[model samples]
Target: MKSILTILVFLVTFGSAFSQTGEDKHPLLTDRFIIGAGWYFPTRDIKVEVAGDIEGLEDIDFDETLGLSQGDNTFNFVFFWRFSKNKFWSVRGESFSVGSTRNVILDEEIEWEDITYPVGGEAEVSFGVALYRVFFGRVISSGQKHELGGGLGIHGLNVKASVEGEGFVGDTSAGFERSETEAFLPLPNIGFWYTWAPTDKWAFSANLDWFGIKIDNISGGLWNVSPGVTYQIIRNLGVNLNYEFMNFNADIDGTDFRGSFDLTFSGPSIRVMGNF
Candidate 1:
């Protein structure tokens, strides 16, 4: 039969040139970069209450006390840039840094004071930054490989408050003064994630994050909630554990002076990750 029809047309032209050279040497979509390192703990408490008419005293009472604690440990850095690699969907750009320590305590008592005006305590150093970030994802399953995500960002803040006592009336040993505040804001974020890939190079991840900042032209506000975990140790390296809750508020007016402040922070964090 004519040599079996020329051996079935040379086996269908060598199987279509080996499936088009394995789809041009394997390509679907790719672009990613990430780098990270972390640890930041911040704690602050402040209270200020002033009741009207200071220069013209009718019923005047003023009270203030502030304490800031930053667990003596700080360092955090992050950078990420990724665009489109549909595990479901993806987009990213991020930058981060945080450091802490600010403590202040002051007390003043008056009614023509038998004598009580002490401002003998001080410490300062606090910082925050988030340039830009926008990310998203979703892939419920890749046969037991899961994923989910959400995002938003933009933030900047700086703080410094220092006051030392025994110098309100006369001269003494511990007398020093400092007060500083710088803020720029527009931050919003949301997150939910779960990932696992127990084989093909190993992976594990978890996340929950909520973030906020409102400056309303200096009627300040900041909020945060965080939970995190990650481990890869290869294929790009990874390690993380984070827990955080933070809130800060402020209102101020100068020239004739006016003030209001509040702060709260909680912690536990450790991180190191890289993917490219």
Candidate 2:
């Protein structure tokens, strides 16, 4: 977090010195398509409670129960399009996924699906989430050297988790035991973005979005922000360095499972982009 703040400060300081005003003075002021791929380092915390038909069990914490690591590495990508005909309007999208699985002896007894796994038995737990988002925006304040915009977006989330072990229950033989949950959600959000260019060759941008509420059986909050600097190496190509942070909390009551899920993923990435 501190490192990201430092980059933001540098962008402001450097941009003010070289910033100029003109219609064609900034590359970002023109319409272009951008594609980028990079790496992501993430941390996660997930929990689920058993309700209704499943009773006499404690809530499950994936990190604590599965002995999952606090950190992991993954891949991410982005696609963006800015229409030249309407310099004020643009569309953007991004996607990423993270997951973990661990095999270890149970530290304590756990009950799921009306079955119980002994404290000394072997267990395997897995958790994962895939995320995708798309949005459209209109540049409300377009200046020669800077621009400000606001828009709405839809974020799609797929959450999956499972537990397997040796256990037994009423009328059931002591053998393999399994319980799992899968949820799909499409959430809408609103956000704002700012872009600054000190010169045609260099630029900086930042954006933030948030949405949350309790309506009916679904409840959760989603937040995301990113800040970055770009340097144009050639007429239609550039290199970018950025920091991204995302955190969300979800409570879903469905036929498969009833509980809550929480996660936070933050990291830095470097990528190259080309514009037509």
Which is the leading candidate under TM-score? 2
lDDT computed for candidate 2: 0.79
Worst 10 residues of 1 by lDDT: 22-31
Q: Distance from true position, residue 227, model 2, in Å?
A: 1.7
TM-score of each: 0.28, 0.83
lDDT of each: 0.44, 0.79
Q: Give the backbone clash total of model 2.
A: 0
Q: After superposition, how far is residue 117 of candidate 1 from its true place, in Å?
A: 4.6
Residue pairs in collision within model 2: none
- In candidate 1, stretches whose alpha carbon ends up further than 4 angstroms from where it belongs are 1-143, 149-220, 225-227, 230-245, 250-259, 262-266, 269-276
> Top model by lDDT, which number?
2
Cα lDDT tens digits for candidate 2, 120-145: 78888888889999988888998767
